[model samples]
Target: MTVIIGHNPNFVPFNGRGTLRHNEPLSKHTSWRIGGPAEWFYEPTDLEDLAQLIPQIPDNMPMMWMGLGSNLLVRDGGVRGMVILTAGLLDDMIFLDEYTLRVEAGVSCAKVARFAVNAGLTGAEFLAGIPGTMGGALAMNAGAWGSETWAIVQGVETMNRQGQHQRRSVTDYEVRYRHVKGPDNEWFVAAVLKLLPSTIEEGQEKIKALLRQRGESQPMGLPSCGSVFRNPANDYAARLIEKAGWKGRGVGGAYVSEKHANFIINQKAATAADVEALIEQIILSVEQQSGVRLIPEVRIVGEYATTKPFMSETPSS
Candidate 1:
């Protein structure tokens, strides 16, 4: 297989029943409203379509799987190969039984929470505050309010690059805080989650409360990734950043959110480079001041832009 950089005219044509486009802008898909273009972007209509399409691409071509695009940063230079967008394309949610729900990777986390509640289930209320999809939640073990995604997972369905599917038990993977490791070269396609019984009113009330708390604490209605840094063991990332006096600091259009120190807001027209620079600054400053290095919870990818110069001004707090 030959590796091609950008816009390969010799790439294999897709014959799936989904949308496929060349040089698709990623900014329209992400929560942060940032990113450049993808060399090849495909949105599969269903699991079958995705499986059929995977094997058509050359093995050497790069591939990236994305959900709602929270907790992600794509560089201005854009992605080089194929990007498979699952949000709104692979959506399928159904109850496997009275106590279990089968959710596809493209279903939003908030929708899953509401669906679980509508089914009189209790444990998924925490998912109401998550901004991404079920696939991302499962991949990162995304959690909030002390409840994690994997705790309720019974089993998962995965698809490899060869268009093959496998059903895997929860015990097949090693689950951790904001991390999960299972079979290599495979991505989650669906999951069966087990939940406890509860009244609809009770579950709705919990979800409402969680959303209210998130609205008040987070930078609501802003162009920003939810959280930039993971809380280190026995210490909060926000606390360290605030203590180190980084709150409301700005680099180009990206600024450390005044409301939440761990959040970097695109105040106005912030580029991906600005966000990355601010992230680096926070990491360096927090590590120097608190003697603890902060790890970014958000995933950063793609190549740096060679055309633009980084701005030097810092915005007002």
Candidate 2:
């Protein structure tokens, strides 16, 4: 049974559902410490609660899907309609057998990596450093070290905007570097991954080594979305940005990290405009400096603060 709560003053109350907040500041959810508010942000208690809640919202209203907010950039203009917080709910992890593990969308990548290692799985060690949740990993085909998120997926379960569910095999989607194109209007709910048999000590050591490398080369403890741009084929993004002399440069409160040019830091009260401007500047600089046009890896969403246009854009997933 699902329980409804009281209504929020700024937005729809949905007959008092699980967790609802109106005009919720999205900066609190994202990594960059920037962004405007979401008109309605709801965190369901669990999968069943979420399933029930989705259909109850008016059909014409716009909807957005988000997880952990690690690889996302919300515009200074808050989002319209409903924004589903997919991080705290749907958390379930189970070992199906010696080789397969099923993980829910809300579980963090870090937690999955540790769980895999504890289960004596070797291949998942690369996921140890990805700060996003499994749902984000699945959406972006997130990778590190050498292995990508989909490389080990045996199957997946997805939920539509209507909260209907389906199970699909890996063959259902086209997977590429930093991209996963699958069924429209559906997002990952869970995945069953295939992993290699290995000793706990071996997997643990690999995780440590990979994390150590990231720490040495990248600026941790700073407010930044991990990587701003995708690396061109056979070329590193950091190398290109550094060559363009963008290191330590910025507009407003956003600056390119000297430690890693690929990262744009929110040093002091950075606005979404500042970050977006920096992104465009980097893109232009890199294109002029090198012939390769670098595409953004970070998912940019929502709109500017001034205009409230009718919502139509779907959240990247």
Candidate 3:
């Protein structure tokens, strides 16, 4: 990890609680390895430090939150203001009551699954294949093999940009497939999950099977967002993409995985522009051919260049 302290000119070096970097390369943070610099990148040391820093930032300055970058894309021009990266912070995991667990936002989905299984929890086995953090899983209602993040949700802890906190129930948010809409300007910091009881052996075998399925069907070795498009109702995005003959197509360095048509991989040196162009093209093609507009599962942010890459050419998939 690239850690540079006191690098941003606008950085206010308070106590030694966290690290700050100016013009931090977001490419280093995202899964695609393809983004420009962030004006100010802040990684809090802990949840306490993060909450403390939240209400102190300038009101005029903009901010964004992100996880492990498994399903996100930042444009080549980069983010303009502070990016509060939670990928490294908020990783506290504790087993609570017999049927409940407390997982901080930064904990990876895979870890949550393993921890739950070790404690003899059964419902979280589906999370073993998700590539992002629990916070991201919460944001997107991430799931696999018929289980969703919100399906097992019990209660969630949230904090507004202003540092105001709230403990909300599952009903507090409008949850859907690949979507979660809740309070404005409030992001997840932690969650309390209710799960079932099972033996560690059962959990381990289930996780292994899920992982094996993912490895066989997805491009695990390449750098790519886990899934580029949400599966449409009654159908899969991969099916639509393949029906449109989009498998192995690409924009610059970004190519659709042969293993799964819905995934875009960075074959070599992929730019954010390259990935964005590919996504737009795929959306257009799929919609034109099938009369269905596929919504992006990937969260795209930041600004793109006025001119695009030489995307008319293709890269070898």
Candidate 2 contains a number of clashing pairs equal to: 3
> After aligning candidate 1 to the native by TM-score, how far in Å is the CA of 117 from where it should be?
0.4
Clashing pairs in 3: none
Q: Looking at candidate 2, what is the lDDT of residue 278?
A: 92
lDDT of 3: 0.85
Model 3 bad stretches (over 4 Å): 1-16, 306-317
Question: Which 10 residues in a row give candidate 3 its minimum summed lDDT?
Answer: 308-317
Candidate 3 lDDT by residue in tens digits, 165-282: 7899888899999989998888999999999989999999999999999999898878999889999999999999998888998989999999999899999798888998899999
lDDT of 2 by residue, 1-317 (tens): 32322332443346434677666789999989888888778887777777777777787878888888889889999788888887867789999998899999989999899999998987888888898999999999999877899998999999887778789999999999999999997878899999999999998899999999999999999999899899899999999999999999999999999999999999989999999999998999899999878999999998897776433332322
Model 2 segments beyond 4 Å from truth? 1-17, 308-317
- Candidates in order, TM-scores: namely 0.93, 0.93, 0.92
> What is the Å distance of residue 135 in model 1 from its true position?
0.4
Output the worst ten-in-a-row residue range by lDDT, candidate 2.
1-10
